[model samples]
Target: MNIEKARFNMIEQQIRPWNVLNQEVLDMLIVVKREDYFPAEQKSLAFFDTELPLPDGSKAMTPKLEARILEELALKKQETVLLIGAGNGYLAALLAYRARHVTVLESSSDLRDLAIGNLANNHVSNVDVVLADAFSFKHTGTYDAIVIAGGLEQVPEQLQKQLNTGGRLLAFVGQLPTLTAQLQTRTSGTDVSTRNLFETVVAPAVGAAPVSHFSL
Candidate 1:
């Protein structure tokens, strides 16, 4: 398990083939060590093309899916991001590297602590991990971008409303056996455009209770 070699293989084989061709994103993926974000037991899966297990009963998103999400979001260096469901803080660290700042909302206290510690360990100082559930938590501040890192029946409109003008959001929408990764952009006031990225299944969020606002 040559770490650097495995990471290069992950980028060249797993992520690149998925259409994640963004150069800045690829570079950030290399700089931010995903392996460092996982626990010892999950470190082996760091560069694998699958989700790493966390103790909160939720899985970190797969490498390719995460890359694709970042690719689509196209984060600006000065943009602020809101990340829902921080898994071990890996994704938040990635977001922090690309964006000016990131605010993570996590329901699981353990996961929140893990995210805070991991981000600190990784030298990511632009992220704040808050112990809050996205399903019930209220977002008062708007963001330049938003990412829902877990599966949801449908993204609530309230969350969508939290997006600033020209903001982008990436999320895995739908339930088991069928889930689609979609990116939404706030084109204008109260109006959003959506694009379907890919299809995949992931575990539910901390307080997932799906409604029905998605059609892909």
Candidate 2:
């Protein structure tokens, strides 16, 4: 396949029309070699508007979904981010480019290793991939941005409590057949406002034990 052509088409067709118009987000989608992080058998689907299964039994967000979520987060060059799931590390790579640093929290050791290898191979050094459950992480400090890389009924209070002043948190909430993408901002030390971005269904996030029982 003509990789460049396919990437362009993905940006123009699947992502752009989905309203992911931020130039930086668009550039990251192109600059990050997404195929490198794909499960070998799913490399051909890297740019397609479909989810790819990851090593941990969780699925990577589709190209457009990743783009939309990235755009929603609106990361800054000097910000620090916490990503809840590491589906082969592709999303972390994209986030790392925009943020000063990214800490990817994954539950499965096997998936964590896959992400570590992929990030290292790609020279994405700004990300620290850790094998830890998102629900039980003992976070000591706040982050400028936080992203839940999979579906949950709602953004948990624990994650909400960690949002820094002026930080942003993005998540896909609700059960299957209907999930809403929400962007929440910390206006001050304890004030948060949420804006519903969109609705879509995605696989349960790896290690998101709190919402794993959700059924279709």
Candidate 3:
């Protein structure tokens, strides 16, 4: 397979058309080599416009979604980022390229280890992969940016509290039937502003707060 051609096609056909126009983000898509992070058997699906399944039953976001999230965060070179749901470390690898450092939280030990290994193989040294649940992990310091790699029924206050004033967060919120990708900014210690960027449904992160159902 012509790997370079496939990569280019992904950027032009899948990512760019989805409105991910930032030149830097488009460039990163080429530099990062998404195939490197996929399991050997699934490498063929790396450039396709679909979620790639991981060992722990989680799925990596599609190329367009990943690029869109990166564009929304607009990461800076000196920023510290907190990433929830480190599935296969592909997103963490992307974040690491744009941010000064990244701390990734993963509930599944198997996925955490896989993430560490994938990042290491790609020589991504700025990300720290941690085995911890996203909802319950206690952050030692606030972050300049935060991204939840999977969908959640709602954004948890615990995660929002970890964002520094002026920090930005990106996450997909809502149930399977409908979900919106929201960009939230911490305007002050107690105030946050949110804007919906797009609509898409992704599997909830493991251990995410469950959606309550009331049956009549």
* Candidate 3 ranges with C-alpha deviation above 4 Å: 212-216
Query: Tens digits of per-residue lDDT for model 3 on 39-129?
Result: 7788888999998888887778899888998988999999999998888899999999999999998889989999999999999999999
In terms of lDDT, the poorest run of 10 residues in model 1 is 206-215
Report the alpha-carbon TM-score of model 1 versus the true structure: 0.93
Global fold similarity of model 3 (TM-score): 0.95
- Clashing residue pairs, candidate 1? none
What does candidate 1's lDDT look like per residue over 114-158, in tens digits?
A: 889988887889999988878788669999999987778888898
- Tell me the lDDT of model 2 at 37: 92
Q: Report how far residue 127 has shifted in candidate 1, in Å.
A: 0.3
Q: Which is the winner by lDDT between candidate 2 and candidate 3?
A: 3
Candidate 1, residue 177: how far the Cα is off, in Å: 0.8
Top candidate when judged by TM-score against the true structure: 3
Q: Superposing every Cα of model 2 onto the true structure, what RMSD results?
A: 2.0
How far off is residue 68 in model 1, in Å?
Answer: 1.0
* lDDT digits (tens) for residues 62-84 of candidate 2: 98988887898888899999998
- Measured on C-alpha atoms, candidate 1 has an lDDT of 0.86
